[model samples]
Target: MLETTMPALASLEAFGNVTDLLVRRAADAPDHVAFDVPADDPASWRPVTTAAFLGDVRALAKGMMGAGLVAGDRVAIMAPTRYEWAVADLATWFAGGVVVPVYDSSSASQVDAIVHDAGVRLAIAGSRAHADLLTRALVGTDAIGTWAMRGVDGIRSLDDLTGRGTHVTDAELETRRTLAGHHDPATIVYTSGTTGEPKGAVLTHSNFLGQVLNIAAAYREVVTPTGNTIIFLPLAHVLARGLQLICIASGMRIAHLSEPSRVVPALSVLRPTFLVVVPRVLQKIQAAAADKAARMRLGPVWERAVSTAVARGRLAEKQDAGRRSRAPRGLRVRGAVFDALFYSRLRAIMGGRVDYILSGGATLDGALSLFFRGIGVPVIEGYGLTETTAPLTGNLPGRIVSGTVGLPLPGSTVRISPEGEVLARGVGVFAGYRDPRHDAEAFVDGFFRTGDLGRIDDGGRLILEGRMKDVIVTSNGKTVVPARWEGAVEASPLVQHAVMVGEGKPYLSALLILDPAESAAWAASHGSTFATGSPGEVRAIDEPRLRAHLQPTVDAANALVARSEQVRRFTLVLADLDDHELVTPTLKIKRREVLHRAADTIDTLYRGAAS
Candidate 1:
């Protein structure tokens, strides 16, 4: 039976506005560390107390109001994950304006599209490069009125505005705070537009606050007043922003790291208990660990023994925790030895305090999810979209399964339509996009249509099938789901990404991008000679021998699919799907864009131009 009801919890009546929420927390925990900014130049870290954090937020709010940002005005912020990003986001809310976030990695065109679409009057860019990109994006257009945070030749700086403005009186700030209520639009988040032009999802303060309430209730057992989180995911994404609000509501300390590569080192230093990450990050970590294990050169027997022991240990741990049915004493001992030898080092690298790694943004590979679980790190996969305030369903502690995106969070409702598309409703749902036409198609019977095909299993787990838009119809009238095929292809060690084609064609085809390092290592090991070439050339090697190596994986994928959906032909591509242009920032493949760009190659593959 599906579990749709949640256990009763405390009512959410503390504050009505985001600013009020922050202020109340600050007053209650004035001396507690609210945020930590770790510097890369040295081993030093800068900490912000709740009082100081609120002080900065108030100052920025006053500064924004002084700069003529009135209620309902939109202020766009483009920055990496940092303290200023959070401060600016809250300040924008406190100033009674909507915050528009642009990912730091977004190109000039993307920035321009968001600013123009959201009708941003002011933009706060983080670095000189970001400011430059904004300038380039605004060139030949009058869409943006001003830029701040990072100084440009003519635009004002956030520091300058805050310094020049008079302190906002408490009463005045209070009035503005009250104006920023639940129903008022708080943010305009742009979807990553993998399919087409990005649409701004207009989310109100109520929508975000509802998500915060759901998250707090979902993790009430684990979340503490002193819990610390390492924030590295881009704040532009709703997932990160929603998590940040949860931390604020629960009074968790947030450590902001400037660089992505420094995440492991920062974790070692901070010893944070919680982390939020995408699937790609986990995939890379697993790959690195496997590479290290391979270098140990254990014989087949030894490797088999170790793997068996590790599996037994995991089963034993599950049984002891009462999560599994049973385990033998001898198997438990073998598992313990394997954990001491291999898993312990991995845990230490994660600072040994990480109790949960929240995986979201995209579907995580099931094998990779199980691998982390086997290592004693519980990875809880969740599912959400920008339009739904980030999380609609997530795995609660002790109830997580590898292949599913758990049950709906408290107060959220997810239903599978007769046609199998996922429909969701609750306070967490956004108040529609800014455009009426888009909003009209996004909802039906008051429930938000997620545009993804999925099923609510008997156990209440949400099993995602694939995007409705990504389904391909073969010439033989058989329906093919590309995502399932892509997932299978990517399971191969040789493949990094795959896009299945052949919609309305005779047979299925695929554009495959091989994993460069793995392919290179394989080539070297086999003593196969290739032209000394660029990374692209190395990745695009068509040595018949290389194809022979990948055939087994291709055959396996073919065996898993219907005969009509089987891949009849495939061409290895030389270039990756560029995140900046082809894929969404969340790293989801933009099938239409990729196929359009590689139209000729896809056609050639269908025509059997190259065998």
Candidate 2:
């Protein structure tokens, strides 16, 4: 049985003012840097002192009020991660309007769906491109209006909003700010909708504030008030948005990066103390570093010797530094050398002072987690959803366990039902979905059912097993979970991602997407003839060769699963899953969609029709 210690649930009573939170922080740290952007070209950053940020926020809020946006009106913000995005979100709340966040890359149909669902009255787009996406979607909808951050055809710009600012008196502005309350709907964040139509999760100002407060208390022991963080993850997501709030309240400097490739460079320039990243970004960095190390031929003997010396230095420093319990001796040493040989360059790429990396959005591969720990930069994996305002549980710096998602955050309760689904009730929980139908299905007895299968161990760590909705049941009534098998298949050097399919079928099969760069290198090493082909041709020519290489991996994975759960066969995909279309923006695999699109190929694999 899992034991839960939850703080008394805070009341949803209104705080009666929203700008009060911002005003308090601004007064305390007026000159402290609030946000920075290292990736924006001219490659310069826009640094705002707390007072300046607050000033801009107030101006924007006043501007919205002058434009006739009343309390509870929905203002949609669709843009990439930038200072403007944060400013708009806060401004909406300050003006007592509910902010609806839409992804920058969402297609026309997706944009239409979200805007229509949220009943958005005025949409604020971040750039000209963002405005264009919305314009196409709002072709005939008169109920919705659009505003562009940059001036665009038939749309109002930020300048237009600021132009009307002089018409509003100080007393009028105060009234708008006073109308803002903690219980007011701050934002309606849409779920990724991997399984079906997306539903809007209604997060209130209090819900977001509670998340920031809980996380701050949880990591107060390690993170100092003077810490700085580089923000690259999408602010449209709850994790990134909540992190921004935490940074503000904690007096930490924040720098935003737009392009992912610029993360290393931005880090080098910012020298931030912390970063929040998804698993895919971390995996890419690890793979890149490993490839570089292999090419340099830094073999075990030299590596071990260097690692040992580095470890000793770290241990001595930790002893002198007078921190609480030091990290594992092996990890300390490996981190030291990794820092000395690799992390310095990595830090140089980041700007050098990163103290911690927070991982979230999906389950991180255990091997990848171990590798990151071994190298010395601790990657703390967290678990949450938009409905939970992002932080339900997290593995902190010193108390981390390799395979689990750590314990629940303060004031949060997590329970595993008889069916193994993780249910949560906490201060961070949202005010239910906007749709009554979704709200009914999403909650059971006041507990928000996560629909994720997981187990809590004797030590209280939460290990996520798989999604209840994605579990495959064979015709013989045997259950085969895709995540467990997919993790195993991905462990193979040749397989990048695999989608296991067997629901209502006799046995399991898969659609495999090979990692082009890794597969090509393996082909070259093995003296295979298809090493230099284009991505499509490489996949086509090397299918047989890859099939041969993956046989042992397949057999090994099968040993761990039941016969019905085992992958009976697989077909290599000729093209990568289209990031713009097939895959979600977060890079999560859409199983049902993918299976439907690849039905012919899947049928061929099961019928043994392909070579």
Candidate 3:
């Protein structure tokens, strides 16, 4: 067994509960701008001071108390990410209630499942529609009241809560806030795990405190007072929630956009210093830039620039590890030229000030990571699960390994089991699921079984392999780890998702989702039409042109493994998967769901091709 541990850089020994984070922030920097909400003009933002935010939390907490919210009651927040989500969340905490975050993308059934499972008594919705959604979802369950953040649809609201709080006193709120201990459950986050039902992961006050304090301490340069960020990822995700708490703990300016589609406009307006993104979004940004270049007839020049950037990135990482010398003079000259011509434009599009970006939720394509790093923005990769609050391991600034998930963050320990499963024991790790039945299987000894297979490199960085449960064993007993091949083939600019499928079959095959934009651009350049189809549809292409284009990716993936483990054939599954049920809210493609949804197509893939 291989293990590594990073000692805690900071702790909450001075504070008793999660409420103290905000309370202390207000005490130390009352006038500090905690958040920036949109002003009259959507482009402009108005700052909310720490003291003002604290007052709002206090008023809301008092209202909860008046509403008969006893300590330990669960208050659900069903909203898109916005300034109000944080207010309602903190207020619930202050009232000695557990916060239950409902993802914005949750279906009515999903909403119903979470509400019933978590024993939620009240919900704060983002709008009238969300309030209605909550109402509809709660039909069969015990009545759960709704409070809207914005609307005049006769429903109670933040203002209503403020009005009701006049009868409650300061001492009552204080007593409630301090009732929960450091390790008490702060939130019951229902985790959207792949191939399974959602489980309520009980992250405690100290779980977040340990995560936030250590992140701030270790990545000090990235979490400074002048730093700012835009939150577009659903606040329901533990990673985003952790980021929000970290920003508050470190006094970073924050702006929230309700949707990821609006992020480009928001980034240009907010000019955030850093960002946390899922890999697909990062892929879109890279693809968008390339498509623009192709449209401008700069495809050849742009291709050369990308190659240069990738080379520079690889060389930089090698140099950092002392495996290579500085970038040669010729490459340096080419890089400088590309910086002026291409990289600068790309940076300007991302608000020109974003020095770095953090990626989790999925594995970033290594080539994509190199390309961004080459262009002067470090796309750092982190690894974790809902059970780990956020990232248990993260790539350190300036010391990033292009393909690795970096070292354990401060206050965490990572070990590889004899069979290669990654085990974690950390302050950020949740104690157990709300349903304790699974706890016996979830933890081995003291370390939480990550269910992921990986290893630690010579320099102590974590490099993930893939999910142990996701391994595909063919009929002939050839064990194929699909993620290894899928990740490799997904590096192509036109491929949105590369899902390998050949379980209990003769040979391995793949189900691919080509990106609409990138594929359209490719077809246009290659003098062919881009086929359009609705989601959940499949087509077997016999076209020579498409085959030739994707064959290189297959060949590349094949080169990584033994002959029997290679993907013999791949077919297209015409899906965008943006809001598809097969995809989680965080954009994780549920492989089992996708395969089950497209079973016939996989059969066709095996019947039709052998190359």
Candidate 4:
């Protein structure tokens, strides 16, 4: 059994609770810009100083207290990513309430499960759309009072919630803020479980404080006030929320946008030093750049530039690993030329000064990781879940390995069990699930069973293979980790999801889901007519040209693994996953459920196989 632990840089013994981090910031640098709220002009954003932000939090916290919010009450924050969401989250903590974040995409049924499970007393919604959903979810449950970020037919807005506490005292709010100790439960974040209903992971003030303090210490250069980031991911996701806290701890200028579409305009305006990204977004940007290059008749130059970037990234990784000393001189010159001609523009697209782009939520494509590194912005990939306050392991700025998620975060221990399951224990680990029944299967001894299959590389980085349950064992007893090949194939823009099959069968095969937009782009590039519809209803699946296009992708994925583990055959489904439909709120596929639904298709794939 291989185990790795990164020592903690600091402890939270001096700090009473999570809210103290904000108070300290307010006291130290009261005028420093802490948050940038969108101004009336869509492109313009209004800066909120540390003092002003704290004042808002204090006011709202007092209002909640006046409105009968008692210590340890669970307040469900149901909303998209926005400024008010952050305010509500901090206010909830300040008011001695446990925040229960509900994804904007969550269905009413899902919301009902979480609300009842957490025994939520107050709910906050971002908009009328969310308010309506919250209203529906609250039906038949313990009657919970609801407030909206935007006022609705009869629902009071967050501003109204703030004004409700004219009688509440400042000292009372301070008392509530300091009430929770390090070990006290601060939030009950539900896991977006692929199988059963979501399980609420009870995270404490220490769970967050431990992560924030150590992470801010670990990346001191990047987490400083001069460094800043924007949050476009739903605050409901533990990763985004954890990042929000990290920024708060460091006094890093932070901003929020509800959707990915709104991120572009703010990028140039904010020029963030770092970014929060998902694998899908990385793939799209790469694909769009490639598509634009082709339209501009610079495809050859673009392709070569990409190759150079990958090569540069490869050499850098080797140097970091204490392998080769430096890049060949000729290669360096070529890379510089390409950087000037092509990569520089690509860097400019990300606001020209992004030091690193942090990625989580899913396994990023190794190829994409390398390409991005080659350009300038190294995708500092990390691995963790809601159970482990955002990151268990992450790559340091200069010590990145493209294909692997970096070393264990400070104060975290990552151990590969005898059965090859990844188990973790640390300051960041949550205080188990709200329901004790679920804890039995989740924790082994003291460590949380991550349910992921991975190995620690010689470089001490964590390279995730796939879910333990998702690993395929063929009839000949050859084991295969699907994500290795699937991620490679899905790196292609034309492919949205790649599900490796052949459990208890001869060899590995796959069910590839096509991205409609990417498929249309492919058709335009190929001079073929693209008919748009659902996979079963679309004629594109039967196109020989499309299959011919996918063949290289499968071949590339095959080359990554052994012959037995390679995808021998496959079929494409011209459909994509909808958030909370096929993909989880964290942006992971429901592999078991997807495969179960396609049982007939699997039979068809292996029907003519040789015994």
Best by TM-score: 4
Over the stretch 228-325, how does candidate 2's per-residue lDDT look in tens digits? Answer: 88777887888888888877777778877667667665665667788788876666675566566778886553455334534543443345336555
Candidates in order, TM-scores: namely: 0.91, 0.87, 0.94, 0.95
Query: What's the best-to-worst order under lDDT?
Result: 3, 4, 1, 2
> What TM-score does model 3 achieve against the real structure?
0.94
User: All candidates' lDDT scores?
Assistant: 0.76, 0.74, 0.85, 0.85
Give per-residue CA lDDT, model 1, range 1-611, as digits (tens).
32253432434566676676787888788888888876655566788898998888888888777777788888888988888899899988988889999988888788878877777876788877788777666666544344556556666677876764476676786677679777889899989887767888889887877778767877975566777888888899898888888888688889876586788887788888888888767777765666677778744534554465446435634664477556577656665776776677777888888887899877777666766776777788999899889988888787776678988877778888787789988767887887777887888888899998888777787988888888998777888877777877786666767888887787788888766567667778889754554422213346788787677878888987778778977877645544577667777767776777678877777674322
Tell me the tens digit of each residue's lDDT in model 4 across 1-611.
38888999988888999998998888999999999988999989899999998888888888898888899998999888887888899999999999999999887788888888888888899878788777777777664478898767788787887888899988888788889998999999888887556788999999999999999989886788988899998899988988998887788999998767778878889889999888988888888888889889999988998898888888777776678677889888999999888888888888888988988878987778888988888888998988998899999987888778999999999999998899999999986889899888898879999999989988678988888888888999888888788888888888878889988898778888788777876778778765556632312266688999789889988998888889888887754466465678876777777776677777778898875
Q: Candidate 1 local accuracy as lDDT?
A: 0.76
> How many clashes (backbone N, Cα, C below 3 Å) per candidate?
1, 8, 0, 0
Q: Which ten residues in a row have the lowest lDDT in candidate 1?
A: 532-541
Q: Which ranges of candidate 2 are over 4 A from the true structure?
A: 8-18, 38-41, 139-144, 151-155, 221-223, 299-350, 491-496, 515-542, 548-564, 574-581, 608-611
Residues 490-535, candidate 3, lDDT per residue (tens digit)? Answer: 7777777888887788898888777767777777878888566666
Q: Which residue runs of candidate 4 sit more than 4 Å off their true CA positions?
A: 140-144, 319-326, 524-540
Better of 3 and 4 by TM-score: 4
Q: Candidate 2: global Cα-lDDT?
A: 0.74
